[model samples]
Target: MNPLYISQKLFEHYEHIEEVKHYYGLLAIYALLLTAEEKQDPVLLGKCKTVLSRFPDHIQHPRYNFPSYRIGGIPKAYSLMKDYLPEAEEQVRYYAEEMLTASRDRKGIMSYPYAPEKELIWIDVAMAVTPYLLFAGLALGDEKYIDEAAKQTFLMYEEFLDQENGLLHQSKNWAGPGKYSEDHWGRGNGWGYLPLAELVQHLPQHSRHRTKAEKYFKDLSASLLPYQSERGLWRQEIPFEYAYEETSGSGLILYGMGVGMRTGLLDREKYFPAFKKGIEALNQICINADFSTERSCPGCLCPGDGEEKGTVKAYVTLMLPHRDEHHSFAPLMFALVEAYRNGIYDLPRDSH
Candidate 1:
C-alpha cells in the first residue's frame, strides 16, 4: 500500500481511543488532510471532516484542563476544510483568537498559568502552538498572530536551546527551581524541529522574518548532524553514553530535513545522506501486520538529576524503554508524507 493508505489505516484505528490529550490525534487529522489534499483523494478529504468532528468546541488540555494544543489544531483543520465547511468559517476563526487570549502573556508569548509547576518554556511549546497560530492568523486575516508565532518560536528557542551543542534542552526549569537541566532529550529535539520547520514553510515570502526562522532551522540541522548514529537513528538520550537508538525523534529530523531540502534551505549534498540514513533507520521498524510490539521512544520528561540537582545527570535513568506507541507513529506519519514528497525513499540505495 502507499504510505498515505498505511498511515490512514493505522490512525483510523488509533484515533478512536479516548486519550487524555487528543493533540496527537488532532495532529493526525491535519496530516490526513494534507495528504488528502496532496493526493486529491476525496475519500481522505471526507474522513478529515469526520475525524475533526470528534473534537469538542472547547478542546480542553488533558492535564491542565485548559485550551492548548487541542484547540490550536482547530484552525489548522479549518484552513484545509473551510471551503467545504463554509458554515464553520466564523466559529473556527473566532476560536483561533480565543486560543491566543487563553494562553498568551503580555508579550503574546505562551503563558500557562495553571500548569503544575509554572513551566513557562517547554520545548514542545514551539511544536504544539506555532503552526496553529500561523494558520489561524492567516485564516482570520490577522498579521498580529503571525508575528506572535514567529516571535514565540524564536523566544522558545532562546530559552530551550543548548547553546554549546545547538540542540535544545527540554525546558528551562523542568526539574526544579535554582537549577537548569541541559539533557538534550530526543523528543525535545522533535518538538523544536516540528514547529521550526512548519513556521519556516508558512513564512511570508521576501520577509526578513522568514530568513530568521531559516537560520534557526539551518543551525539546528548542523547541530544535530554529528549525533546521528551510524545506524541512521538518534538515541533517546542523544549521547551514546545514555540510551538506545530511537525512532520518533529520528522521524522528526527526517521530516525537517525533507522540508529544508524542498525549500532549498538545506543543501542537497550536505544533508541528503542524513536524510537517506533516517529512512534506512525507519525501515528497521519491526511492524507486525497484526499490531505487535515495535521499537520506539516512550514519552519522557526531563531526567531528574540527583548529583547536580537539574543541570546535569549523574546517570540519566529517565530513558523509557521502547514500545509501539504514538511517539513513534506520529512523526513517522509526518516523515512518510515528507519522504513521499521529496522522493527520499525512491532514491537508489541498497535495501536494509
Candidate 2:
C-alpha cells in the first residue's frame, strides 16, 4: 500500500473517533499538520485548522493536568496555524511563558507541580515540552525560550541517561528519591530521542546547541540499533528478548532515525536496512486493512505500586498493548510520513 495513502486513511479514522483533548489527541493533530505540510494538501491543512479550532482554549483534563503534559503539541500547532488562525500567536505565547515558570527541582529540571511525588521528573517531558518550546522560540524570536528548550532536554539527559548502555531510564523518583526506573521502556526512549531529533532537524545550523543535540541523537540511535528485534521493531521492555514487539515506540524511533538520515546525521547505508524493515513491518502488522492500528501500548507511566513499581518486570507485564489506542496513531503516521519523505513508497516485496 502507498504510505501517504495509508496515512490519510489513518487520519480519517482518527477524525471519526471522539475528540481527545490530551497529549495523544494533540499528537495525532501534530502528525496531521506534518502530513499536510509534506503533501502540501490544502484540504488537509484546512482540516488541521478546523480540528484545532475545536480547542479554542486549553481545557484542563480533570486528571493528567501536569504543566508539561498540558503543553503537548500546542506550540507546534500554534506555529503551523498562527498565520491561518488569528489567535494562534496568543495561545502559544501563553503556554510558552507558562512553561518557563512551571515548577522544577533544584537541579533546574521541570517537575510536576502537585502533591504525591511532586518532585518527580521523567523522559516523557522531552516530548511534552522540548518541541513546544523550540517552536515557541522560533516563532516568537526569543532566545530565552530557545535556550530553555535545549536546557530541559539536556538536564533530563544528564539525570536519566544510562551512560554504560546509552539507553535512558523512563523517569526519576517514580521508584524512589534519587533513583531511576529500572526498565529502558521503548516509548520512554522514543520520548527522549524524538525531541533531540527535532532540535537537530529544526535548530538553526549556527545555533550553539545543535552540535550537542546531534551528539545525543546519534548516540541514542547507535545504542538502540542492537536492541531492534529481528522483526524490525523494538520490544516493550527494550532490552528484554521476551517482551512483545511494540509499534508505538518503534514508530517514534523510526521517525527519529528517518530524520537523522534525511539530515545526514545518520548514514543511510548503515541505517536504511533497519528503517526499511521497520516501516515494512509496521505496514504489515500494526495497521489493519481499514487503517485502524493495533499493538501500540496504551497510556503507561511508571505503572505498579509497592515492590513492582518502576521495575522492568512491571514494565513488561503491566503495560499491555491494545487495539486502536490513542498513543499509537501519531507514531505510525510519523513513521509513515518520514518513510514517504525518504522515498520509501511501498513495503518491501518480501513483505507483500
Steric clashes per prediction: 0, 0
Tell me the tens digit of each residue's lDDT in model 2 across 153-188. Answer: 988987888888999998888777877789899999
- The sequence of per-residue lDDT tens digits that candidate 1 reaches over residues 5-64 is 555555654555445235665666666666776678988888777555545554555653
Number of the predicted model whose TM-score against the real structure is largest:
2
Reference-based TM-score of each model:
0.85, 0.94
Which regions of candidate 1 are displaced past 4 Å?
16-21, 57-84, 102-109, 115-119, 291-293, 305-316, 345-352
Clashing pairs in 2: none
TM-score, cand. 2 vs. native:
0.94
